[model samples]
Target: MQDWAGVFIPLVLFILLSPGLLFQIPGKCRIIEFGNFHTSAISIIVHAILFFSLAAIFLVAIGVQMNLGP
Candidate 1:
């Protein structure tokens, strides 16, 4: 349970935060251009912030502790 949470939670966050996998933020040029479909630099930055913020809120809501040492 605890071990699963530790691994699963961060893995989920990483997938969710990955560019173009979940979010399709638009802008001028593509962050990782693949023909026509692509994401922009500014949009990537903005979405990264948004995703991190949401992740923080979620972690807090789930009462996940962040400790440095034992």
Candidate 2:
């Protein structure tokens, strides 16, 4: 774990999780047309995308491989 030396993994996890906790999934999405994206599914999709993006960026910056192979 050379790349993870002296690292604080919990901080990265917190950053990745904060968006989901803080985002207000609108009851009715108004930014688009011909679509019903106000559902919980859509909100969850957006949250997942955001979380992954944050994780990707943070992990890359810290020089870690984005993998969870058992």
lDDT of 1 by residue, 1-70 (tens): 1335445566787776666666555535543433344566776787688777766776756757545444
Clashes of each: 1, 0
| Shift of residue 66 alpha carbon in model 2, Å | 16
- TM for every model, in the order presented, reads 0.52, 0.42
Q: In candidate 2, where is summed lDDT lowest over 10 consecutive residues?
A: 30-39
Stretches of candidate 1 exceeding 4 Å from the true structure: 1-6, 27-37, 64-70
Candidate topping lDDT: 1
* Candidate 2 off by > 4 Å: 1-20, 25-39, 62-70
The TM-score obtained by model 2 is 0.42
